[model samples]
Target: MRKRLFILGLLLIGIFLFIWINNKWIVVSEYTINSSDMPAAFDGVRIVHLSDLQRTSFGKKQLPVLEKVAAAEPDAIFITGDLVDADRFKLEPVLTLLNGLSEISDVYFVTGNQEISKDRAEEVLSALKRTEITILENEKAKWNREGETVYIAGIHDPLMDISTYDPLIDVNFRNQEIEYSKRARDYTRESLEEVPFTDDFTFLLTHRPEMIEEYAETPADLVFAGHAHGGQIRIPGIGGLFAPGQGFFPELTEGVHEFGDIRLVITRGLGNSSFPLRINNRPEVTVVTLEHEEVTGLNK
Candidate 1:
């Protein structure tokens, strides 16, 4: 009996350790985006992408995330929303992260459902405006390099449409989601229309990877998104078990997905919401490097 109890204790300890590591461990995902349309001046431009912080802090004042971004030497950093969790909203963690990141490189951001759903959403937005981070709301910003330009456009999360009410418990929640998704797509299309279509590469930053279809309809060369939280729990070869928007066995949980000529990069994100812990899926930070490929002769 004594031996059996001892073994059970060991097993419980092991389980606890596993859960802690999975939730706290941070991993870096690296990718190279090759595009024939990439301007020569922007080639090798490294971008550090972060998302869905959800009020999770790594180390003191987000030292772990900051150190990783600084090490990557990014030309720019893009955060695709959820800096704070609506359920347990706080501003310090979000501000700490944004302040640290701004020191490293120019930071750009777009909102996620969490930001829109929070009661104090306006406070969060106001604080962000005071910082160096540029908040893109249905608009575009230009980055110039050696006389060449790349456009970075961002759209508001679909949740903004229903910010005044609680959509989660509504009798028509599913129908509302469907309708909001379409609205989100239209918002993307309309926002892009305002950009005066150009040949230079364009990057779209959004919070929901599930909206890839809507984003693909635009002329963006690449899209960065979060909010799936790696399905909240990954299953090795099987992928994520469930994501808020994608539901069970979601297809767009993480990694790179392609839609026609456009590519989308989804970050698993650094924090957790709704679900308390992450299983098998560690918090993720993504680094993407742009490679310009020349189209020669007949292709040109």
Candidate 2:
């Protein structure tokens, strides 16, 4: 009887391991963000946010990830950054996915910390340009439909070049033990100065979710970010366990986080950077639908 029990335990362990491995594979998460600020014409617009790819590939030529994006039938796809891992720095998977996505729809790309951290930054940038992906490097792009415009802007990660940051870190934020919030906010404001807040729906694509406060300070109606990688591991009732910028028990690891009038959508991200294992945290591709409401409250 004891021998049989031991075999049964091993089988259970094997099954558990298989399920864990499967969860690391790509999973599409859908979200709808309703805002009073959204334009009537832009309502129901679908956006697929992909982040922290970090040299991870799904199936042949990233077909699993691509197939999911294609299935969404997005109006636009926003890639928040970290397309390649800083250490590994693989090109084929990155280029393959980018080329595939560009053909499907309008693809907007942004820089994550890894993009600059990697030695092959210029090479990656050049490939993106060649693919005809709109690379928003501290610049804004306009998408107009039916004479209505949606403004999209992206900022280079502050860590890419620290010399550019404002010397004065907001002590108030630091005192609260919030790392990089002040500096990130300052960097975001300076980077986005030219793109003014207008009546149109404004979207900011940032790689770091830690700068949510700074992003909210701006006139952007919506912000999409990825970098935390779902805190690598999540603890059921406690949410994500840890993240780079937000640190232990990160408050803004994944899902929707609000900052007054503005909303931030953080993707769990597909791929591992530094951490090899994930527990209860699956690779994700988030789809957010723009909802225009006549009377808006903080309900959704």
Model 2 lDDT tens row, 1-300: 999999999999998886567455678899988876677888899999999989677878888888899999999999999999878888789999998998878999998878877355677788778886899988788999777888998888765554333325555655543445556556666776745556677899989888776777777888999999998888989998899877889888889988888889999999888877677888898999888888636564
lDDT of 1 at 256: 89
lDDT of each: 0.87, 0.82
Instruction: Give residue 299's error in model 2 in angstroms.
Output: 15
lDDT of 2 at 130: 85
Model 1 over residues 4-62: C-alpha lDDT tens digits? Answer: 99999999999999998898888999999999888999999999999999968788888
Which sections of candidate 1 miss by over 4 Å? 176-197
Give each model a TM-score.
0.93, 0.86
Query: Model 1 — which ten-residue stretch has the worst lDDT?
Result: 188-197
Worst 10 residues of 2 by lDDT: 162-171
| Model 1 / residue 274 / CA error / Å | 0.4
Residue 163's lDDT within candidate 2 is 34
